[model samples]
Target: RRRGGGGGVETAADFARTAPRAGYLHKLGTNVRQYKRRFFVLRPSTHLYYFLGPNDAEPRGCIELDGGGVSAVRELETMPDGRFRFEISLGGDGGEGDAGGMDASFASANDDGGGGRDGGGPRRIVLEARSAECGREWIDSLRSESLPYVRAELESSRSEADELRARCAALEARVEEMRLVERDRDGAV
Candidate 1:
């Protein structure tokens, strides 16, 4: 579950076991467009978390790549200072609102330019990888992990919809029975 303050706690051993990728990456600030080096960890659960450093107990923020949280991931043809860079486009709302598990202070601190929360368009986070191979690996892993989470979410939604449909049908049948009883009473009179 996503909390409003920070990411879930994970010990070093547990983080190493659960995280497929954990390293330093330069993240472009949303408000200023300036790149800042951050320690990033990609968990098996399709959550990409970045912390102030590798030893931080909690993440500064989390990007949920499931249930329409992420829209696309692509490499940029132009390189910034010859770094292998890629952009992850977020879907509507981008899961960065009140429920995205991003610390309020962190968001406000980085978003001093006042453009971060305008909700104007899909939010994109650009990341610079250390090498071309690493960039490709990150892209592939993100794509692969995201699909299973999205599929699971879809399946859950379908099951809920089916249950709702069955309930609606039952209610309609009861209403019809009530109408028939009323009609019989009126005819008897």
Candidate 2:
């Protein structure tokens, strides 16, 4: 459980080099509702959740908690190129975090001077669900099956990018050949 941004001082490169923990994938449940509920029980962990928001520009969103008072929010923006560009930044001094506290019970959780986490103060999470069904579905996927699906989608995208590059290279070669043919014809004239 780290405190501020400076608290979790691991460099991005160091984080990438770290191996996934054992039983990390196995802990996930099959049902979405069950998974969302699990977060309430998490002792020390971080998770990203994908949320479909109001429109096309806001398809995917995320929630992250690192067992400390600090948390983050991200909104996914869909680009014209069929890719998602993330607009992400951590809230300063738990400003954005205040939204989750709208629910009365959450305040009770923080009633004590210390928040839920061990030795930490005020465990805050972001919550935004328009309707009950939407909220339920979002929580379920995040807790249960979303991780595997996201990984698979990333792999498929990489493969598609490789295929597209090969096709572009072939087209360039054909264009060069056509140019050479035109130069030969001009020389003959």
lDDT of 2 at 8: 54
Error of 1 at 174 (Å): 54
| Per-residue lDDT of 35 in model 1 | 78
Residue-wise C-alpha lDDT for candidate 2, range 1-189, written one tens digit per residue: 222466753322232233221111101121221212111211113433221211212112223333222332333333354333222233334222221322333223321121122245333333333344444444444433334445577799999999999999999999999999999999999
- Model 1 residue runs over 4 Å out of place are 1-14, 78-81, 97-119, 148-189
Root-mean-square deviation of Cα positions for candidate 2 versus the true structure, in angstroms: 17.2
lDDT of the candidates, in the order given: 0.68, 0.34
Q: Quote model 2's TM-score.
A: 0.34
TM-score of candidate 1 on Cα atoms, chains taken together: 0.60
